[model samples]
Target: MKKETRHRATIIDVAKRAGVSKSTVARVLGGSPNISEEAAERVHAAVSATGYEPNHLAVGMRSGRSGLLGLVIPDIANPFWADVARGAQDQAAKEGMSLLVFSSDWDSAKEAAHLRALRQARVDGAIINPVADNLDGLDRFGMPFVLIGSSAESFPDTSSVGSDIAQGVRLGMDVLLAHGHAQPAFILGPKSKLARARFLRAINQHCIERDIDPASLHTEDSDYTVEGGKEAMSRLLERASKGRHLAVFCANDLMALGAILAVRDAGLRCPEDVSILGFDGIPSGAFSWPALTTIEKDGRKIGSTTVTCLFDEMAGRPEHGRVYIPCRLIERGSLANLLAGNTDRLAAGR
Candidate 1:
C-alpha cells in the first residue's frame, strides 16, 4: 500500500478557513496596528485550525525584511569576542530579531566571503569587526552595515561603535608614570589593525609629553595570543637594560597574562620585579594569579551599541555617525609601585 503525502498548510489555507481576505491574514501575522480585533481573532482561530505556519522567506520577500542580523568577527575563541557576540545576541532577541554570527579567523578573504553569504541570506543588516582596514567590497553588497572596533578613516560614512583607544593608552601611561616608571615597554598587536596603530601613536605621544625619549621605549609586535605575548615578553626581557625597573603595557589581557608568565620564568616577580598592564578587561584577568590591571573597553556595551546603530539605520533614522565608548582603568595586583623601592634585580639585565 502506498502512503499519502500531506500538503503543508499555508497562509492562504488559514485565510480560506477564516473566511477572510489574504490581506487581512497578512496584516494579522505582520502585527499591523491597523488590523481590527475581530479580524485578528478570526485569523488566529483559523491559523490554529489549519495548522498553518508562516513562511518567513515568503513574508520577507513581500516586506523586504528578513528580521535577521549578521555579526562577523575575527576570532570567536577569544573571550572578548565571545562576550561581544553574547551581548549582540541578547539585544537582537529583545528587538524581535535573530542573529547569525560568523568567525572569519582574521582572514580577509574569509571575511569578504562571509559578507557575501550574509547578503545572500537576505539579512536586514550586518555588524562586522573587519580583519583589516580594507573594505573595498562592503558598499557594493547593498546592505546596511556597522563597523565594530574599527577605524573611521576607511569607511567614514559607515556607523561604528568602539572605545577611545587614545584615551585608554593615555590612562595606562599615566598609571605607569605615576608609579615612577619613566618609560614603559609595549607588547603591541599587528600594525595592520587600526587599534594597534592608535595605541602606538598614543604611547609615543605620551612618552614625548613626559620628556621621555620615544625611541627609548622598547616595542614588540605579537599575534594577540597568549603564546605570542609570551614570546614577545621573553624577547623584551632578554634585551632589557640592567639596574632599571621595567614596566610593560600589552595590547590586550591575554598578552598581559602571558607577559606575567614570562616574568616568572625569568626568575622575576610581577609588580615587585616587573609591572604589567593590559587592555580589553576580559573576565579571566580578574581571576589570574595576580589580578590584571587593564584598560577596560566593555565589549558587551560595544556589541549592544553596534546593534542599536544598525537597527536605527534599518529604520531609516538619522545617522549618528561614529560612536566612541570611553575606556576606564582597572587597577589590580599585576601593577606595582616601583617608587616603593621593593624592586628586585633581574638575572638578565634589570
Candidate 2:
C-alpha cells in the first residue's frame, strides 16, 4: 500500500486560513502584543488547524534576538564543570532563554573554534572559561561574554567569576595548622597555573605568620588528576622527613583521592599516619574511604553568577571587574584534630 504524504504547514497557510496578512501572523507568533484580540484568536485557531511550526532561525532574523545563550568550558567531564553547566542551564530557564554548551578540552584552538561557532549561531551572549593567555577570543567576539575559572583572576580588566583561590588556600592552611601540622606537603599543579601561585603565596604567608621558614616547605608538582596526585604523593612520601606527622594538601579533589590511595598503598592509614586535604569538594569526595577534608568551592554559584555578569554586559552595563564566590571548609574524616582540647570543636565542623 502507498502511504499518503502530508504537506507541512507554513505561516502563509495560517494567514490564508485566518483571513489575515502574513505579517500579522508573523507578529502574532513573534509575541508582539500590538495585535488585536480578535485577530490573535483567529490566528491561533488557524495555527491549530494548520499545525504550522515557526522556523526559529527566521524568527530570530526578524526579531533581532535568537533567545539563546552559549557556554564554553575547559572540560565537561569534570564533576565541577558538570555542576557549573547545570547551574547555568537552570538560570537560563529562569530567564526564558535556551543555552548551547561546548567544551574546549583546554585547547586554545578548540576554544577559538567554539567562539567562532557561537558567533555564527548569533547567541545573545556567552559565558566562557578562557584557555588562552590573551583576550583574543573575547576580542573577536562581537557580543558580550564573561570569563570564568582559576585563570580568570589574571584578567582583571574583564568581567569574570570564580572561587576565591587565596581564601581557599588560607582556609586549608588553617585546618592543617589546627591539626598540629606545621611542616606540610603540598601537591600542586603546573607552575604556570595561577592557582598554584595563589596556593603557594597563601602557604608562604601562613608560614611567615607562624615564624616558620618558608624555605623549609615541601611540595610536589602534579597534573591535577588522580594518577598525577598518586605519583606526586608517592615521591613526596619517599622523601618526607621521618618520625613526624604527615599533612598533605592536594590542589584538587581528584588529586587528593589519589593521594589517599598512595598513602594506603604505602601501608599508611589516613588521619592516623597521614592526613590529606583536598580542594573542590566534588561528590566523590564524600564517598571516599576517609571522606575527604576539602575546601568546598561552589561551582553552581560560580556558573549562575557568571551568567548574571553576562546579563549585565548584555544590558549595556560595564562589567570590568571580577566577582568571586567565597570558599568554605569541609572538615571531614581525612583531617584529624591533634589539639587535646579541640576534638569537640573539629567534630562539630564535620
- Backbone clashes (count) for model 1: 0
Please, what are the lDDT tens digits per residue for candidate 2 over residues 127-163? 9887754554457777888888877777788899998
Report the C-alpha lDDT of model 1 over 1-350, residue by residue, as the tens digit: 99999999987899898889998998898889998888899999999988888888887898899889999998899999998899899999999889999999988789889988999999999998877787676677578888887555467677888888888989999988888877789999987777788889998898888788889889999989999999999999989886566889999999999999999999887877688999999999999878999999888888898899999988889886778888999988988776665564332444
TM-scores, all candidates, are 0.86, 0.87
- The best candidate by TM-score is 2
Model 1 has an lDDT value of 0.87
lDDT for model 2 comes to 0.87
- Candidate 1 positional error at 301, Å: 1.5
Question: What TM-score does structure 2 among the candidates reach?
Answer: 0.87
Task: Record all residue pairs in model 2 with backbone atoms less than 3 Å apart, i.e. clashing.
Answer: none
Worst 10 residues of 2 by lDDT: 341-350
